[model samples]
Target: MSYPTIPAYQTQANGAEKLSREHPVLDFLIDHQEAFDTGKMKTEPYTVFHVDDFVFTKSDGTVLPPGEASWKGLLEGYAPFNKHYHEGRYACIYERNGIWEMVGFANVYANLLVPGEKTKKDQSGRQWDVLVPGAFLFTCVKDPTGPKGFKVKSMTLFGDGVPVVGEMMKRGMVKAEDLVK
Candidate 1:
């Protein structure tokens, strides 16, 4: 598929909730999500790219098939640490918006979007690595309504995912916040 479908996410994934107790960074972030006075979300990050600038060739000068690492889908390689990765959900990281905090997310798994079977060398030059393009995922978009102080927004992306969305996706993954530590 030229573009990946958006992923479905909840405030707490199946595994992320457990990890929140382990560290403060994860705890406060997950428990207390920052919202506007009416509980409107301030953050709306939605793009990701790899560290490398879409390089199809390896340092050794080898070509690779597409899907080497796609930003479009959850890379299967991350399967082993699904729980640990989900913990990233608690990471209430945000992008800068005129010095104000934006939205909070469970995790933003940004990486290289390499085609399948591509080989790339790390800075250490010790081994080959597959690249996954960066991607932005939000827990949910809050739309508060009524006196009860409630809201309902789409938790999952609707329809097919577009590789680039407006200007955000075109910007690529440049911000430190967009990447996973």
Candidate 2:
């Protein structure tokens, strides 16, 4: 079998998977994502979220701030679902003066945890993959107390959730009222 050659420009944009491993901070984040992809978040990436004051905000103005709720909420939400980090392109990634940042577009493949009423399934009743798109910004700061001497302080996820939400609603996995502001 043969594979097509990727252009240099394209390879550079999709270098998240090829980033040099010498940088510990970026490595930390990558490790976390890898753990999530392989369904080992509960054990492997658990400590990556040790930042007690971490904040996660979505593009839709939804915010999960420190003390309001912890990463445990995220764990619970993902506990019932199977997700795999399909691909990502980090348009920008750098570190300076103890701060590390990355901005990129990512796709995650997931399936409905439970069979939905209108879910599209195969003859074997296997649900199809849901490709979730996300444009994200991750900012990390040096923290001696953090598990890796660094921690993710804030994360901003920019994306059009409508498509995925619409799909979910169609599959009977979510209701219109559930997404109401």
Could you tell me the lDDT of residue 67 within candidate 1? 37
Strongest candidate by TM-score: 2
lDDT of each: 0.27, 0.59
As a TM-score, model 2 comes out at 0.66
lDDT per residue as tens, model 1, 19-45: 333432223333323321112322221
Count the clashes in each prediction.
Answer: 23, 0
**142-168: candidate 2 lDDT, tens digit per residue:** 778665677777777776656566767
Instruction: Report the poorest 10 consecutive residues by lDDT, candidate 1.
Output: 45-54
TM-score per candidate, in order? 0.18, 0.66
